[model samples]
Every structure is written in C-alpha cells, then in structure tokens.
Target: MQKLRRYLALGGLSVGMTVLAACGASPTATTGPAATTAATTAAATARPSTAPAASATIAPAGVTRTASASVTTPAATATRATTPAAATATRAGTVTSGTATRTGSPTALVTPSQAVSNLQRLDNSRQTWAFTGFTVAGLSGNLNPVFEYNGGNQKVTLAAGGTNLEAYQVGGVLYVRAPIGGVIQADASNPLAAPAQTLFATPAALLTALVPANTSYTVAGTETINGLQATRYTASVALTDLGFVNPALAGQGGTAATTVWVDTTQGVLVALQSNITAAGSNTAATARLDVTQIGQTPAIVVPR
Candidate 1:
C-alpha cells in the first residue's frame, strides 16, 4: 500500500506542473490559485533521495502566494513562470515535493481512515473512467502546468469542465486538453498496458505510474464505502528525481504527498488526493481527483 501511494505521488508530481500549464494560465503569472510556491521546509529536512529535490508552495486564498525550503545545492533554484492572470477564481493547491508538515485547515485534519473512505467511494463509483485533473501547491519557482502521454496511435483528449479538467485515454496513450493551449507528452509503453485497458486504462496506468520502481507496498487497513469495506495500502519510497529534465526547477523547495483509495472488492482506484508544500512559506494547495463518469469500452490498441 505504501508503495502504491509513493508511486502515485511521484508520477502525479511529475505531471502536475505540466498539466497546470495546459489550463491556460500565462507563463508569467504567479498569484492565482494554481500558482507554484516554494518547497516545504519539512521535505528538505528528510533524508535526501537519489533523485534531486522537487518542491513548491501553495497559498490559502487560491491567489498569489509563495513558499521556500532550505536545501544545500551547488546550483540555483529553478523557476516555472506563467504570465498574468486574466480573471480570479478559487484555486486549489499545487503539487510539489518536500517533507511533510501540518496545517490547521480542514483538509489537513483528515484522518487516515477518512482518507481511506474517500478513496474507496471513488473507486466503487466508477468502473470505466474518464476525466483528469492536476494541481500543484508548494514550490519556490515558476511552474508550467501541462502534461501529455502517447499510447501508440491512440488519440486522447482532455475536456474543459469549469475549474476541473476531464481526460479520455484511448488505445494505450493518455491525452490532456486544457483551457490553455499547453500540451504535454509522456511515454506509456509498458507491458501491462493490455490488462490495464480492460480495467480502467488511463486511471489504472496513472496509478501504476505513481509507484516508484523496485518498491514494495501492502494493504494497511480497510475502510467502508457506502456499506462496502475497502482495503487501504501504504508504501514508502525515495523517488527518482526528474528535475534534470527541466533544470529551471531545481532547489525550489517543493514536496509531493498523495493518497489513493482502491476498492477492496474490485481492486480499482477510485479517488486520488494530493498536497504540495513550498520550502519556506506556509502556502500550499490540495487537489482531489474523483472518477465522476466512466465511458464504454472502445477498441483497444497496442503500441509497437
């Protein structure tokens, strides 16, 4: 279970920033709800992993905010800058990386059991899934909010739904369509692609991608979802850092923490939640991705 959470956290952090860019925010704006902040001081204090630190900050108002964490590095911090905000809306937290910290917010008070229940409900509610949403909260520099993945020849789409975005994963690839013109591409050519498509292709692959390599996870406990009992797992990992892919993001004091719920009866992920903290500041954002609608099975394809 722990391994599952960690992998989901890592994959989510990696793609969170890129997806945000696809939402249509400019490259220079930093004050909106989705703005990236500094890393959480907590993550910096943890044992260093083989991967470089990936962190950012999120504010409470969903407006301009920044966070930073203390880290010793030879290089400077990377910044993901977006342009000015055109309008104001309630924004959630950004997803970053770093140590864990506690806040007085209601979301922070969520008990481990409650978190599990949320996940179970999400999983039980959807058999076939569609839609995707990404959020980043804590970091120190600028952020680009967009991500894209290719599955052989499958064409995917991310539909705009108010503040939340929807995704459709066909074939073996995933596509993200945002309010903005931004797009992201990732390689999802894995041996498990076929089986995953039968379950919930995009969501399943997404959950699997979040797990770190060579890690172990176990179901820790169970929670009831609408009278049905669901199992929960916890995993721990030191993820491989992808900061080198964009040097501009190093030393930004961001940390990624996420929780996922899988229905014990069916063994499928139903809900995903994440929190990101910036390094120095108290700013952070929390995001939740629930499977609201599922689509009928389509012709499946395998990438060469």
Candidate 2:
C-alpha cells in the first residue's frame, strides 16, 4: 500500500478563480487546487458551492470551515452533521456546539509515535471507514470545499463554495448533480472533466490522500470533534513533503504546522488541521478534515 505523501488538497477550489501559483507533488499525497476544484464542481450537483476542477491539486480558497458532511445514505446520510463539542483537556467547562472547552488530560492513545504506527498499520490493511470534512484555501476568497468518504468499495460526495456544485463517486463511476442539470456521468477518458473521482476513487486512495504522515506527529493533548474524544498531535512539514510546492506557496518555501486528532480506542484518524505559511506572505494557508465515524462504515452506492 502507498502512503498518503502529498497529503492535503489545499485549494479552496474557487469556481473560476485561479490561485497565485501552482502546487507541487508530495510523497504521501498529490493534492492541490485541482482536487478541490473537482470536489466543488461535482458537489455543485447537490447545491451551489465548491471550486472548479482543472487538475488534481487543491486550490486555496477563503473561509474557515469546521467538519460537516452529508453522506449518500438515503435517510441517515441526508443532512450535514457537525461534531458535537467536547471539553478540552486544558480548557475549563464543557464545550457546547463547537465552542472550546478546558481540561488537562494529554491526548489519549498510544505514544504519539505508536499512534502513527497504528495509522501505518491501518493504511497497509484493507479497511472501511467514513469521513466528512472541508478544506480552506486561498489568501483572499473564502472557499470551503466539503467531501464525504465511505470506505469499502468507496462512496463519496463533494461540494464547495455556497453554490450548487456537487458530485459523488461509487465503485469507479462518478456522477454530478448540478442544480439545473441532470445527472452527469464521469468520463474516465478525460478525467479533468470529471476529476471528482480523484477525491474518492477508492478507500485506500482516499485515506492515503486524506491522512497525513506520522513522521512529524507529536502529542498535542486531547480534544473533542463531532462528539468524539480524540487525541491530538501537532507537526510541521514542508509543503513539498505533502506534495504542495507552488510558486506562490512553496516558491517562498512552504511550511505547514498541522494538528491531528486520532481515535485511540478505535485506532483511526478522526480530525486534522494544517496551517501553511510561505516565506514571503503574512497569511497562512489552512486546511482541515474531521472524520465523522469509523468502523461502522456507511453504505455509499452509485447514483442512477
């Protein structure tokens, strides 16, 4: 199994807007503006939102997004759901609705290193899980691209911005549900035209693309995301390390500080955030993912 080297698809996926510079390929995942674009474009089918898909890179967009997703289950996966707030180990009081809480417990899990080892182990094995989250990019525009992945034969849905840009994937086939448009089939011959598949082509592919490497993970304490108690780790990696090297971002030497939350009890990655900085800019490029569930995989069937 291949590791998620290029990691983040760090683009807001602006509908028609272009990023200052292009991103490079990383070792774990090869994400950039293109991935987000594809996500947004396909997601448009469901609603009006998301960036445009011209390639496989994550395009940076404006706006800060917390984790929320709408899977493809007819009833259970109908609406977007938020992570129930939990008390922080360092902060005080129980967090209500996305508010911060206080506590003092270290992030629970194996050693930070061990947590990563578990991540690697999971990556190497055949598994099923589900995730719902969004990525934020762009120094100016607030573009939030959302995606939901259900492993095991793979079922995914993507949407971004606030417009009706949405799409989904099942098996190897993809479908777009544009607002006024009917169901659009994905064309493998010209992937860029239907790059949404790049985001959820497979469980392993999606995990490798969504999860970061453990090389830089360090225990950062415990936090709650979506009502789940998860151990958090902080790390810093080069933009190129995750496959993000852009003339605007990496040209100035792209470096990112990331926070990750893992469900130690279940040995699964639950949530993560990345703050990317360039040598020449004051603004930081940020991206995030919050896993909604693991083990109890949801059913993601292809669209008709």
Candidate 3:
C-alpha cells in the first residue's frame, strides 16, 4: 500500500550500488559519446588516435570498444539498485494477498495452516493427560473443572457459580456427590464410550465435537501448564460443534471461542478454556478444563 513504497525503492538502490562497487573498473564505464565521436572522426580523416605513423598506425580497437560498453552498462544498472527493495517488500508482506507488485508494496501474510496441521497430528497421537484452566465469558460466568482420565476411569470436580459437584467413574459404574443430589449412583453413561473412548479423550472429543466450521486456528505460542510445556491454539467455533448429548450441556449450547493447550511432546490436551453464548442469547458462559496430571494420577475411589 501507500506505506511500503519508499522502502522498496531505497532497498533496490542499495543493492545495485553494492554490486557496482564490487566490480572495480570495467572498460564499459570509461567509453562515452565524446570518445566514440572522436574515434569516428579520426577514422573518417584517415587518422588513428594512437599513431605509429599516419598511414601505418592501427586504431586501439580493444580500448575503444571496452570504453563504449562501460558507459552504457551503468545506465542499465540503475534498475539493479531496486532489487534489494523488491526483496524487502516480499519479506514485509504489508499488502493484501493477490495484489500486483508495486514499488513499495507488500504481498501476503503468513498462514497458520502448518500449526493447525500440527494440532491435528497431536489429536491422532492422543494420550493420558491432566489439565486445569479458568474461563470467563458473557453467558457463562466463571466455571472451573479439574479432571483426570486413565483408561476407562474418570474422576472430575466441577464448580459453577456457588454449586459444586464431584464425580468418580470406575469401569461402567459412576458415583456422584453434590449439594443437592447427595450421593448419587449411575450406571453406564461412561465418558469413555462417548466418541473416541480412551486416555486423554478430550483432545479427540473437543476437536471432533467443536472445532469451528470454516475458520482458521491461530497458534498463539507456548506456555507451561502445571510444570508441563504446551503449545496454545485458539479458535472460534459454533455451539453445535460440542455435540452435546447431555441435557445440561446441550441447554447451554451456543458458539464458543476456545483456547486450548496441548503437551508439545505427547500432543495430549493439557488445558482448555472457552467462552460460550446460548442459541438465542448473546450472554456468554465461560468454562475451563485443565489436566495437570499426565499419564499419572492416584486411584479413583467411589464413595460408598
């Protein structure tokens, strides 16, 4: 755009001068119109500029030819100076994509396609992981969950508003303790059976359930989550992507903008945070999941 033009021209000039200065002296530089005219006139008068004798002297053809080349080369070389500027423009990429090249304009921004690909690969190599994250959004205000999954077992604690609930699952049996429900027992409805069904199923489930449709994921950077190194990725996805089978979760359905962290080494989902909005409302709800334990956690015991 208008911002980049001055830079490209200056860059090209700098490049050309450097190339010219390195060449030392070439014959083309010294040859000029005046020297050429003098030689032409001498030939017409039957005289040589370097005379052995008027009739016997040979013109210094080599020197005259070299000088002629040198003079013209420098003019043509004015274009070369702009070469460096062109290179810098490409690097800066300040302009929009698919634009024609101009003196000081840029081309295109770098895409996050590679980072998304890496995240997909991590999903493919899912493993046992534990994470924790605090989330805040307009509809859902401040809900935090810390959970761990080992094979077919699950232990999770959820706190929302002023309500707290804890659940433990061993094989097909699930145990829940809550302020309103006291000690509740449930059979089947196992998380392992929902979707991929394995250790650190979160990465596979979240990716399958709620990756935003027709959107790009941005790799914000890396961070240490609970003493573990993880790569952070963020995306805005529709509410439907969560694939909510649970009545409670389905009721709160809305578009969610999520930020997730995955272990760089194992590619397991280490932490996730999301802001959610309801189907017909603009109010946002926030939720967070952090797996602080990875591949290691104490046994899950059911309360009798």
Candidate 4:
C-alpha cells in the first residue's frame, strides 16, 4: 500500500446587508432643540399648617410608645404582601425550566479527545458509514469508501485509480470482489489489501491510532452534515501526534490545523479535516474525511 501511503502522507491520512429606514427627519428637531433657558424672579412667603400631630405619652416600665405619619394604599399593601411569594414562585419556575433544558439537550463534550472517544464507541456498533478523503503528499488523490459493519462481518467499496473495488472480510479473511464478479483471496500482492486488512480488521483501532492525545482543541460551533446535526471542533495538533517520523519535521512536532465534527445526537464522529505542514518544507498535506449513512445503511451480504 505504498501508493496509498504516499498519497496520504503526514503520519498517514491527514486528510448581509441590513437596511434601516430613516425616521421622518425627527419631526424637524422638535422646534430647533427647544429654547436654551428662561428665568423669572418672584417673591414668596412660607407658612406652617395647624394640623394636630399624633399624641405620644411615656409608657410605664418596660413599655415603649412612638408616633409617625405614614400611610399606604390598599393596592400597595397587597402588593408588598404578595411580592415575596410571587418572586419565590417565579424563581422556582425558572430553575425547573433551566433543569429541563439541560436534560433535554444533548450534553456537549468538553474536549476533542472525548469526542474522538465517542466516535470509537459508535463506530464499534452495527452501523454504516461512507468516508471521502483527499490527501496531498507527492500525489494528490481522492478516496471515497463506504463501509458497512454488522456484528463481526464487514463490507466496503474502495476507490482506486477510478475503479470501484469491493472488499469483504468475513471470518478473518479479506476477500476482494473480482472483475468477473466472484470473490478472490487478497494476498500481499494487492496494494489495497494490506491497508484494508489493517483498517477493517480491528474496528476503530485505526481511529485511536490516527488522532493523538494532548491535542489542543476548542468547540468551533454546530453544523449540519449529511442530514445529521454535528458539533464542530477545531484544534492544533502536532504531526508527531499522528506518528509522522519525517526527519524534515521535528520538535514541537510541526503543528497542523485540525477540525472534527461529531454527531450532536449520539456523539459519533461525523467528519474530520486536517492541513499539515513540515518545518522547512513549502509543500503541505491536506485531507478531509466525512462519515454518513450512520445506522440506516443496508446490511452487508457476503458474496455467495
């Protein structure tokens, strides 16, 4: 699979106009900003009213008496009495509503590593997916592969040099569909056989090997891909994290801008893209992979 590896180099497979209407000239500035100011001098006299004040008397020992002039309306009194209870009820309702929202919406994965982990878990189940990838190393190539997994049986349609090659692995043997339409045992001679065996034989182990730990990433946003809602995450990952051992790239591992999409509903990995570069080399490798069809894919049937 040197051709495939060469095509996927980089640790392998680093894949308005808002219109505002003018409001009627502000009514001609409402009389030109109103007159500056006007003052008039006038004489006045102050007088005190002869209303009787509340009487207060000194009480006996251990007693106290005080007087004041304050009045409240019936509506004001009723409002003051019920305000606390109303506020308490509103607070309780708000808390309940917030809790419901948290429970109803899917919990977002805090880290990209967690998203990758979820991908592994979902990839192991009985599901189907199609991955389309493009890589640039020495040769620029595109790969579209559809995979179907059920229990321990799997089938895939691989793309190679404009040929749709079908492959099936059952009971520990890789079988390639011949041009004449029967099954052929895949040996070391076929370029795609080894890679297919390595990739499909162990479920999602390749994914674990592909994405590295210690990757710094953040949640980019949410997007819809292949009819599934997915959370997008962006990160900077070192080529070394992907197991790139090129002598031209060393130290800090030469970072790559990486982004991944995971299904918002089930946490399954939906898509990924990476742009990788070497330390001193001008050429860069770009790759993208997207998984679709999910649990709705048809069953894979071994060729009779």
lDDT per residue for candidate 2 within 1-304, as digits (tens), equals 1334333233344421343233433432346567887888777764533333422234322111211222234345333332122224324343442242212333342544444445444422222232222231211234334444455244334333453444655565667664544556657664333445544433333234334454556676666765677777777765532233222332355566766677745556666566666655564555655555444445666555
What is the per-residue lDDT of model 4 for residues 101-158, given as tens digits with 9 covering 90 to 100? 5444343633556666766555333333322222212112455555676555678766
Runs in model 4 deviating more than 4 A are 1-105, 123-140, 162-164, 179-181, 187-192, 198-206, 241-253
Worst 10 residues of 1 by lDDT: 95-104
Model with the higher lDDT, candidate 3 or 4: 4
Candidate number with greatest lDDT: 4
lDDT string, candidate 1, 1-304, tens digits: 9999999999998787678688876555665433333344345545354233332222332233222223322123322122223111213122111112221122333433444344334411333222222212221232222222222233322223223333335454553334454333223553223322332333333344344334454555556543444444555433233232122334554443655555444444445554544456554544344432323223333233
Evaluated against the true structure, the overall lDDT of model 2 is 0.47
| Span of 10 residues, lowest total lDDT, candidate 2 | 61-70
lDDT of 1 at 222: 59
lDDT against the true structure, each candidate: 0.38, 0.47, 0.53, 0.57
In order, what is each prediction's RMSD in angstroms?
50.7, 53.0, 31.3, 43.8
Candidates in descending lDDT order: 4, 3, 2, 1
Better of 1 and 4 by lDDT: 4
Task: Highest TM-score: give the candidate number.
Answer: 4
Model 1 CA lDDT for position 274: 49
Q: What TM-score goes with each of the models? A: 0.29, 0.46, 0.40, 0.54
After aligning candidate 3 to the native by TM-score, how far in Å is the CA of 53 from where it should be?
Answer: 70
Cα lDDT tens digits for candidate 3, 1-304: 7658878988998887788778874446567766888888879666443355633433566667789999879877977878888988886675533344321121012222332334444312212222223221211244344555556576656556675556666776656664554656643463322221221233445445444436666778777885767667788866662233223444456677778775565555556666666677554445555554444556566766
Q: Count clashing residue pairs in model 3.
A: 27
TM-score (C-alpha, index-matched) for candidate 4: 0.54
Candidate 2 vs 4: which has more lDDT: 4
